[model samples]
Target: MLDASSNRINGSIPLKMGEQGNLNYLNLSNNVMSGIIPNDITLLPNLRLLDLSSNSFHGAVPVTKYSFSPLEIIDLSRNYLNGGIPVEICFIVTLTTLDLSNNSIGGQIPYCLDNLIKLTSLNLAYNNLNGQIPLSLVSLLEMNLLNNSLVAQVPDKYRYCFPAKAFVGNKKLCGNIKGLRHCDLPFFSIIMPLVPMSICIGASLFLYSKRFDQIEGPGIQLLCAFLPR
Candidate 1:
C-alpha cells in the first residue's frame, strides 16, 4: 500500500520501491514525477494497481521480472513520456485496463501487443506515434488511437472495431476509414511531357542524322585521297 498520488514527487520513482515485496496498490498519479520509472519497481511481486498517470515522466516504462506479472490496472496517461511502449507490459497477459494517452510517445505500435490476452481497454490517443495500426489489436474490446501520426491503411480486419475518427490528425494516413480523404495523385504530374517530346526529337534526328553526318564527316579523307591521287 503505497500512495504517493497528487504530490510533488519530482524525479524518478526511487529504486528502493522494489524492496517492498508486499506492496499491492501503488499510486503515484497526479504528481511531478520525471525520469524513467526505476528498473527496480518490478520487484513488487504483489503489485496490482500501478497508477503513475498525469505526471511528467519520460523514457520507456521499466518492467522487471517481478513487477510485470501481477499487474492488473496501469495508468500512465497524461504525461510527457516518449519512446515505444514496453512489450513487457503487454506480457502481463491479464491487463484489464491500460491508459497511455496524451503524451509525446512515438514509434510504431509494438507487434507483441497481441500478447495482452486479457486486455479489455487500451488508450494511446494524442501521441506522436507513427506507422500503421497493428493488426494484432483486433482482440481488444475497446482502443483509443486517435490524434496520432499513424500513416497507412487500417486493415479491413479492424474496420468493424475502430472508426475513421480513431485515426485523425495523421496527414499521411490512408485506408478504408470513412470520411478520411482518399489519397489523390495526378497521373500527369509524374509523367513528364518533355520526355515524349525529347523522344520525338531524338527519333527525327536519328532518321535524318545521316545528312548531317555526311556534311561533318570524311572531309579530311576526301582531301587526302584526292590530293594523293
Candidate 2:
C-alpha cells in the first residue's frame, strides 16, 4: 500500500515498481509524470485502487494488453492519452468507477462495457468519441458524457435517468430526452408501412367499382332496348 498522490512527482514511473506483486493500493495521481504507462503495473495481483489521473501521462491506456481483475476504481482522466479505449478494461468485473474524461481518446464506446455490473460512476466527458450511446449503460447510478462527438438518438432508457448536462455539447444527439430535440423518423421507415395498406385499399376499391358496373350494365341495356323499340 503506497500513497504518493498530490505531490509534484516530476519523472517517469520507475519500471522496477511493476515487480511489486503484493501491492494493494497505489495512488500517484495529481503529479507531472510523463511517458507511456508501464504494462507491468497491471501485473500487480492484489491491486484494488489505482489512480494516476491529473498527470501528463501520454500514449494508450496501460491495460490494453493485460487484465486487472482485482481493480475496483480506475481514474485516468485529465491526461493526454489517445486511441480507442481498449475492450479489455471491461474484463474487470470488479470495476466500480471508471473515469477517462478530458482526454483525446476517440472511437465508439464499446458495448462490452455494460458487462461491468458493479459500475456505478462513469465519466467520458470532453473526448472525441462518436456513435450511439449504448443502452446497457442506463443501469449506472452516475454518468457524465458531455462535450463529445456522439451522434444519433439517446437510448430511450437513458432519457429519464441522466440529465441533459451529462449529454450536452453534442450537436447531433437527439431523442425523447428532456433537453434534446426529438429524433426524426427515418424516411423509409415512415413510408414503408403505409405502402402495403394503400395498395390493399386501392385494390378493394377497383374490384367494387367493377362489380357495380357488371350488375347495372345488363339492366340498363334491357331497359333501353325494350323502351326505345
Candidate 3:
C-alpha cells in the first residue's frame, strides 16, 4: 500500500511504476500532477484500489486490453480528461466502484456494463456523456448520473431506489421522478385526437341521412352532399 496523496507530485507518472508487481494499493489524489494518466500504471496486476482524483490529468483514460489489473476500486474523477470511455473498461471484471465524474468525457455510456458484474457504485455526473443509460446499469445499487445528455425512461423498479438527483441535469430524461417531467408521446398526442373526431363526424352524417330517408327531392340532394361522392 502506498499513500502519496495530498502531495506536490507533478509531471507524468513514471512508466517504471508498472515494475512494482506486488504493490496492492495506491493513492495519489489531491495532487498537483498533470499529464495523461500513465498507461503503465494500469499494468499493475495486483493493485486493488487506485485514487488519482483531484489532479490535472487530461486526455483520454488509457484503459486497454493490455491492462491485466485486478483493481476493484478505480477513481479518476475531478480531472480534465476528455474522450469517450474506453469499452475495454468492461474487461476489468473485478471492478466494484468506478468514479469518472466531473470530467469532459463525451459519447454514450458503454452498453456492456453487464460485464462488470460486481460493480455496485458508479458516478458519471458532470460530464458530456450522451445517450440512453444502459439497461444493464439499472441493476447497480448506487449511481450518480446527474448533468449529462442521457436520454432514457427510468424504469419503474429504479424510481424509488434511485432518486431525482441521479438524473436531474438531463433534459431528455423522463419518468416518474420528482424533478423530471413525464416522457412525452407526441405520436399518441397528435394522432389519438383525430381518430375519435373522424368517427363522430361520420356517425353524424349517417344519422342525418337516416332521418331524411323518407323526404323527397331537396332532402335527398342535401343528404347526398353530406355523404361521400
Top candidate on TM-score is 3
Model 2's TM-score against the true structure = 0.80
After superposing candidate 3, which stretches have Cα over 4 Å from the reference?
193-229
Residues 46-97, candidate 3: write the lDDT tens digits.
9999999999999998788788799899999999999999998998999999
Candidate 1 lDDT over 36-98, as tens digits, reads 877667556788888999888877766644555478888889888787776666678667898
* CA lDDT for candidate 2: 0.80
Best lDDT among the predictions, by candidate number? 3
- Candidate 3, residue 181: how far the Cα is off, in Å: 2.1
The candidate 3 region of ten consecutive residues with least summed lDDT is 204-213
Lowest lDDT 10-mer window, candidate 2? 204-213
User: What is the lDDT of every predicted structure here?
Assistant: 0.72, 0.80, 0.82
Q: Residues 103-175, candidate 2, lDDT per residue (tens digit)?
A: 8999999899998999999999999999889888999999999999998778877867988789978878877
Candidate 2 stretches greater than 4 Å from native: 188-229
